[model samples]
Target: MMQVIYDPLLPWAAIWASAAGVVLIVALALWRRLPGWWLRGLAGAALLAALANPSLQDEAQTPLSDIVVLVVDESASQTLSDRAVQTARAIDEMERAIAGLENTELRVVSLGDAPGDEGTLLMTALSEAVAEEPRGRLAGAVLLTDGRLHDVDRAPDLPAPLHVLLTGHEDDWDRRLVVENAPAFAILDEEVTLTLRIEDQGQAPAGDGLVELDVAVDGGAVRQVRVPVGEDLTLPLTLTHGGTNVIQFTTPAAEGELTDRNNTAVVQINGVRDRLSVLLVSGEPHPGERTWRNLLKSDSSVDLVHFTILRPPEKQDGVPVSELSLIAFPTRELFLDKIDEFDLIIFDRYKRRGILPAIYFDNIRRYVEDGGAVLIAAGPDFASADSIYRTPLGQILPAAPTGRVIERGYLPELAPLGERHPVTAGLPDLAPPGAEGAPGWGRWFRQIDLDPRAGQVVMQGVGDRPLLVLDRVGEGRVALLGSDQAWLWSRGFEGGGPQLELLRRLAHWMMKEPELDEEALTATAEGQRMTVTRRTLADEVGELEITGPDGNVTTAPLQEVAPGRFQAEVTGPEIGLYRLSEGDQSAVIALGPAAPREFEETVASGAALEPVVARGRGGIVRLEDGVPSVRQVREGRPAAGRGWIGVTPRHAYVTSDVTVTPLVPAWLFLVLAAGLSLGAWMREGRR
Candidate 1:
């Protein structure tokens, strides 16, 4: 509703102005003797009315029903180091404080963990709470948390007073360890580097010294390295063996460290190389010559160097040395000079022709003894009296081939123990999803009957003869594939075999891939599910023991996911590195990337809401002690002191216009003037 009032018709001020104009006009007309003086006065009065253009306006406001907003952060980080207990106390105090105020409603909202991202976003929660109710009805806002607000910058600008019920003590502190850089896998026999960073909670001491760093591979102590603290250091790792090398890097806890759980880290580097460097030495050319070369050369990454001894040491071709098509082999260059350059050394069917001096064979034997891989594809000569077995190389050869070549066809199959070896383990099945049927493989038609001197028989031939065997010399690995007819499997001799894939895995495993580790300890993370696997010769292991962010420990049973491997899935209660243990073995698996949102904004400062607080003339009160009461003060006045905070009423007002009148009509005014003048004239005449 609205109303308007004003002096419009015959206003005295307007009337006086009109009369003055008329009087001036009349005086001028009388002096000049002009006509139409009254018409000019009428024109002045008409203009005055248009200039006034007057009206009145007023409004009535429906006062707000006061409401208080309470934002609570219950994210993962809040559960850290006693933050949860503080938050619960603050919320209860706020509920009791707001209950004493009249016409006030309490709205409580709890913020939980955010997926993928970290921390409690106090500002965002407050913004949502302000939006849920009417803006005019907002009384004030209160946030309860450990001051670790990740999205603190997003704090809402509240129209009403805002306060912080800060959680945690100013003296509280914590410490954590960080593994900065860990390679997915390290190359076999090649040095790989890792970086680690250590951090202190609260204020760090001025001086810190060398820390003990231990490297464990497949649960064996390869080395114990001493490294400096604070700065990052590159730790060298030479993957001594192939397959998934579960390398655990650990640093013993210091005297006052908050927790030693984060001091250890477990990383599974999947051992692999784009290509392998193979050196194939052949005493003479044969059908298998192209087979070994083609198999290796087909892969672009595999660098193959093939050498065949066509000229015997004793009998050089009688023709002129220059006339012979074959060039003299540089025995020193291949053996003594750069033996370590190749990953694998293969000796295929060489007799006692002595192309390489006895010293060269001795070096070859030393080569295998010192961290090198050797494969022997024996032929008919392996059974002869003039076999390389008669030379210095006999010491390293796993088996002495019987001077017998069995041309009988037989399906190359794995020995009983081979079924559990990472190379041949889970074979006969292609899909790893399930072990029902891995892959169907073809058969090899020919095999060499050999006598296993000292080696594990991985494959057997007719009459249960050892067809394939493996042995270790010094730190080196050796494999003996008894026959050259392996290519028969590649040609689909018996239902298209996995010969190619099998050979590939066998070679890589011998080279030591961090992926196919037989005895390994590892951890994997995807969302909330974390998988911990322990691969060992032991038939079974106890359930995984997990220590959560809050230092709570629980054990979960592990199920056999594959042969010789035990696995368990742990749904983490909070985001941070979780400690997984069984017996003396423990692994620090990062559950999520960083601290959850609740701990992001760790400082309990009011800078985020200072500007809005000033605009509303409101002050903030900390919740560490207790929440002060809420009381309304004068507009632009303090409601509470620095210890207790609240808002003051603004004393707002609306302007209203007043209309005035003399209780006299236009005709009555004219009559009164005329009668007064007439009476004065009569009295003067009578006098």
Candidate 2:
């Protein structure tokens, strides 16, 4: 290329002044009718031209290839139906067409699913690709995707047009289950409402508009219900336990649906107890009686109804009953009428004294069998003939008193099984075992001798006898503390142990808190990494069987982290639900959102990218129709047509070399001006 440029021999101010003087002289000569006035003006003009030197510049140019960004979506949704095949074909065609163009290049960027539950980030990938190339050389951008991008708000400002080659059929359709609203925590045994809906997108076929929905809790049996589609369904659920409750809802996959990934959804709601109601019945007043009262009363959420047998019917102090200020115990109302309302019933050193009849004891046994918890904190009375074991409640008692009491100072020790039991697993850490110089926890001065009957012995006293036993009776639970000196620890006798913690775990475990279960499987997730935990009383566990979101099954070995706890960490996990099982224990956990953004809508559509494409003056074409021909178009013109897509030709180049040459020599211009001035002078002299 060649262009004329100025390289002034003198300052611009001097050049302009010389030109102005020449113009004024020419005008004066013309007005006075002077001879050869035009010749004198021409000579003056030549001298001014020499001062303003002009040069021609020639440039050697190299054409730079125009960059066309091709972002191919390989996200989860893009694999539905024939969209993957369509994307592959469109990319091949685009590469060839861009290559055939004279000075154009294709920059292919393959995009996958975003981390966590963040679906497809097509716009983010495109923006990054565009930034890698020079804006002046960017001709246009093309996307081969299903158009279900999740990050549309991050679209970049492109210097060229944007085109979309949608990759689904016109008749594509999908049915998805959507959970509109669900609470993260709900009160146990109380009805909580959840809002859900089933939607059909694209060209849905005609049907009865009713689908069967399957609902399950904690991986139990599933219940099916028929509900109408496209309408929100309010489901009322009551949690059974006080911990995480996994509720799964699924609908059968329909025929001709794009994908079934969205047919199932999971919701985890933690169950919490509104309040704890405990019934405390003390046979006689003792030092440990106040300990039970203080422990139960300390928690504001616990409602305690304590009744101590201060005056028995057999005791006659020869004083008038009316003179004694004591409220009579309501045995009938408490043990028969409203026993089910109380969550736990504690018998502290209680013995049969004709107060509660045999019928009341039988009713108490029935209550324990029907999912009610009972704890027996025995004293010397339990080893005597008046022991409650001789009553109907004895059937549910885990141990039988041997009619002996040991009154020697002894430090309680955890049994082997107690080290693995959740109730007593970590109690040893509170006060370490005694050494030669140091005594561990406070010593108990008395222990009731007992023979283990059915339950597991969790603690031992002097002579390796059962000090504490826990058992399961029917659907309920029972605990036996064979000593009444637990309060010694509360007094900080010697060195106190975990007195409060031990009682708290015992209570929660009897109430069937899921976290306190002896055998459990659970999982937690952070991004794509998952930690699987197995808690059991067994010495060891086998490898865990893990079923991923895509129905692929794999095995992971567990390593012992604690006495009874095992764990395994899984990396690079997919976003969705995972089912883990080892032996009879199974657990379901979600690594990301229950309904990932990718599968929320499976049918392909270009509505999300339409506005962006319009702003760039581009068009949306379906790959179902043949791959469009790539053509070169001018900027600010239509960049797409019925059977073809257009890219703007930037024609950008680089100037490798430049040469500058003066238009005329300064010496030649000076000589020409002198000759003209002399000619004009002679003419004037002759006149």
Roughly what TM-score does model 2 have, to 2 decimal places? 0.95
Q: TM-score winner among the candidates?
A: 2
lDDT of 1 by residue, 107-208 (tens): 999988666665566788888889988776677777676555667567666667776666655554444446679888766668888777655555444555
Q: lDDT of each prediction vs. the true structure?
A: 0.67, 0.90
Model 2 residue 418 CA deviation (Å) reads: 1.0
Which stretches of candidate 2 lie above 4 Å from their native place? 9-44, 318-326, 432-439, 673-687
Model 2, position 625, has a per-residue lDDT of 91
